[model samples]
Target: MKHFGGNDRDDDVRLKLVETLYNQPTSLMMAVLTGAMGGITAAIATQNPVITAVGVALALTGIVRFVLYYRMHRNALDHDARKLERIFEAGAYAFAGLCGLLAALTIYLHPPGAIQVLTVSLSLVYGVGISARNAARPLIATGQLLLVCLPIAIAGLLAQDIVYAILSALLVLVFAAVVSVTLNLFRILRDQITAAEVSARMADNMRRLARTDVVTGLLNRAGLNHDLVELLMALPEERMLAMFWLDLDKFKEVNDTLGHPVGDRVLAEVAARLRAQAPDKAAVARFGGDEFIVVAEVGDRFESERLARAIAEDISRSIRIDQRRIDIATSMGVALLPNDGHDIDTLMQSADLALYHAKVGGRNQVCFFDTAMTRDLVRRKEIEVELRSAIQRDELSIFFQPIVDLETGRIRSFEALVRWFHPEKGELRPDEFIPVAEETGAIITLGNWITAQAAKACAQWPEDVTLAVNLSPMQLRAPGAALGILTALRDAGLAPHRLELEVTESLFLDDSADTVRFIDELSAEGVRFALDDFGTGYSSLHYVNKYPFKKIKVDRSFVSGPNAGRKSDAIIRAVAGMGSTLDMDIVAEGLETIEQVQAVKAAGCTLGQGYYFSRAVPDYLAAMLLAQERERDEKARRA
Candidate 1:
């Protein structure tokens, strides 16, 4: 079977052929009047009863043929394509036969003077009509010319008189002239038709390109806009339209880690699946990067929900690209027309809010638009504004929680945590505002401030006491990250060895090469790096060995609670044992209870931090705690 793409050449030929048939009526009517006049003139010039009677009969015959030709042309529109072509072919043959008959009669009757001249003139004029009218269908034009002129020329060649011989040569010349002119005219017509087809094709291609997403082969934002408007305009009184806004979860992670070519394949597969899953009447488009929109007509909310669910199931299926199988999930936001919104822009905004809620509610599910979700966005906006001003107004402050040495009961290090002292809302933890900061790109500014403050505080601490600061994934992946950290150390007059940068496994998933390389640079410069919140993300034995890190912090999730506590103990033991062989120090974080501290110590943890030591406090209080510890150590040494 042939591919589904259209063929333009065939269409051009067909259009021109039909046009040739359509043009015949106007030219055919002219031929009738001229032929009748020529017959009358021949009769008058001859002045013979037999000649007049024959001329009158021929005129009447011409009139009959004229009526037939006119009827065929008029009825062409009512006929099917094949039948119309057949009608045009019959008309051409009939006209050509009439011309030949007139020529033969003129020659055989030997009409006198002006009558013979008029008969010959009729044949020449009809030759022009054949060439003009049938140029588009050159075969028809050629056959008609042969019928009109060839018979007359052959008959003239059989005559004995010199004048008759000259007339025959003239007739032959007329045939050649018609043939040559019609052939060239046909070529021009074919070229013009081809040009027109090309022009039309180019216009269609331009529109397709403008409205298509090149990567996914789906409709782009412009196409979506056009389709949405069309959907709105054509809406029925009872029917409702639903819009599904689907965004791929962790798509950037795939692109950043796997390269754009792999990312492009993923996007294409996504579009193909979405299109395949969508209903025939649905209009699917690529609304944003790794985001798709489906606007489908539905009878009710149940139908809309079913469609969204099916789309989600289809999109979530695994895709294999470049011999690597990747599983990606889509979070969909649905909004129904006339219920959620009436216009395209309003529906899109409503859908976006729903999508936001879906992401917030934990991805890999669908959410419908509701008025209540507006408050969540409003709070987000408020947080965004306050976060931007957090550092400038000195609303941001760092608190230090000590990482205690398990063997010596000494403060080994302090992890600096940022607390937003909101004048109205009191103290806010990283959980409440960190995501917003990262989303708003305010984390970089805030992180930089925290790093500087942490470095300055660690500088005042005892030489053995290092400070660990959790580095946001945003800060780690951004440009100038290494320089920013080094600048912070220099400005704070702190040694690189006195500060440890704590990074989560999330950073590795984002851009492993860049993140690993940046950490390598800092580690080479005598700065320490540790995997923070270890086992909470995509942690692996391979990753632990590949990266140059001095310490691993066991995430709190495995360290506390019921049966989780036993599992945490087992996990802690396994990690500490593995860390020992790798020459890595293990720090058990979020140790709240004395039992938690004892459990980590029994598990061979070298360091521990949580409420067991002290909750994170201001720099002055943390300094005093360290001072008290240092003074106690000195007195014990003196004793």
Candidate 2:
């Protein structure tokens, strides 16, 4: 077996193999010193004028070659491949051989007294230089040793001098032993180099994997940011960058209904389409999930908008996967550099904001970010940034709205609404920043904080009046959703039966199995479940049948607006009847007017919550309101 069993054919390994052999600087330096020494030794050992003349000429030739090689090395680029290494090795070994031949001739032509000692000394010194400098590459050391010491050993053997023959035999043995030892050294160096190469390849693979999106073979968010920075650095002064943030509309519904396999195929198809349509200079990156970014340098704002529109038009085409036809549409947002903001982060944010507007205002189109949108986004970001700190600093508080039992005119429960006091912006309402918090993933932290705080508040409330808190879809999707509530209830000493966790019908459009399982697990713990904003989502009845909810809160939209087919009161009555059949209580939302209140009560609605009872009140005010209502009831009983 080949002892060194790696790919010796690798150019990097091959180049490393010859490093010591063609060390130009070392080779030239040694050649100059050895050439001068050889000439001087020849002159001193032999008075023969012919040998002296030839030695000087040999020294001059070696100096000239050294000068030439030095200039060549100086002119070469740092990355110049070692293509001439073998040729340079040949020249170096040939010059060393010539110097050795000159010295060998001197030994042959020497005058009698002390000359033999001087000549042998010259050969031994050269052999030492070879082993010392070139031993790292065994072949280089072997070549230099044979050239410098072999000729002298052969000359001594031919002289038939007993002492010279004994020394010559010893020199030959020493040369052979060094070649073997340094060859082992070369093998070690080669093995180390091969191991380094393997490590380098592994690092490169890891870097590529980090930058790539596994699903679509596109640059992920990190890679996109890196490429964007590189592109900006390479861009011309007059050119501006445009970022197009593209989101596949209704993608969540596709994942929910058709399944992730089809959703994945759709995402892949979208990437393929974008790759085909993107400009040569544009970079297309998958920003995870159904989002993608296409960035390019634009000559003007019109070109930026034009590119965005073209991309939207192409991606909106119908796609078919496994015989399931899907009509897909994309919403795109465009932001121009310098005009939007010069940095990659600001530009991407602007593009994302514009994409949001396009999606919300009837998707399948492109929207360029206007100045107004920038201001609006800036405000939203400010709120989102502060909202993170607000939750941590205990600046968020829960305000409860009374859900009244309309028949008895008594408050059955109080629903908790999170309110934030922005130190600079005054009291900010939930509608302004709740969605932002959800989008930024701050909701997870805020949700936990809300649950903990609300649990504590429930501990302080009357036992019969349960504390109801709205849950974001993110909260319910967590695996520990039920566990978190159970833990909080246990910590606060509140009975699970009195705590109502409210969720909207939109939860039904999510991963249905997980959602139902979450609700079931929590309901099993005696926590009451309410389907809030019931008719605002598709398939409310489907979700109602799937989960055991104790109450359904009618969405104010259908209750407040006149029914397209009949009076709004009729829809309310129908929902109330359905709730009755399910043994669930029905509460009408957005009952601001006394007439709307009377209408829902007359329609058989058992519970109601809206401005008609009171806008959501702070915890202290809610306590007072409940107290007043109790006192009034007692006075009525006495009367």
User: Lowest-lDDT window of 10 residues in candidate 1?
Assistant: 1-10
RMSD (CA, angstroms), candidate 2: 8.3
Task: Give the range of the ten consecutive residues with the poorest summed lDDT in model 2.
Answer: 1-10
Cα lDDT tens digits, model 2, 392-504, are 67688888889999998888899888998877788898898988888766787788778777788767777778888889998877658778888988998999999898887
TM-score of each: 0.58, 0.71
Clashing pairs in 1: none
Q: How large is the C-alpha RMSD of every model relative to the true structure?
A: 13.4, 8.3
Regions more than 4 Å wrong, model 2: 1-7, 19-31, 44-50, 75-82, 112-119, 135-137, 381-396, 401-415, 421-427, 435-463, 466-639
Q: How accurate is candidate 2 locally (lDDT)?
A: 0.77
lDDT of 1: 0.81
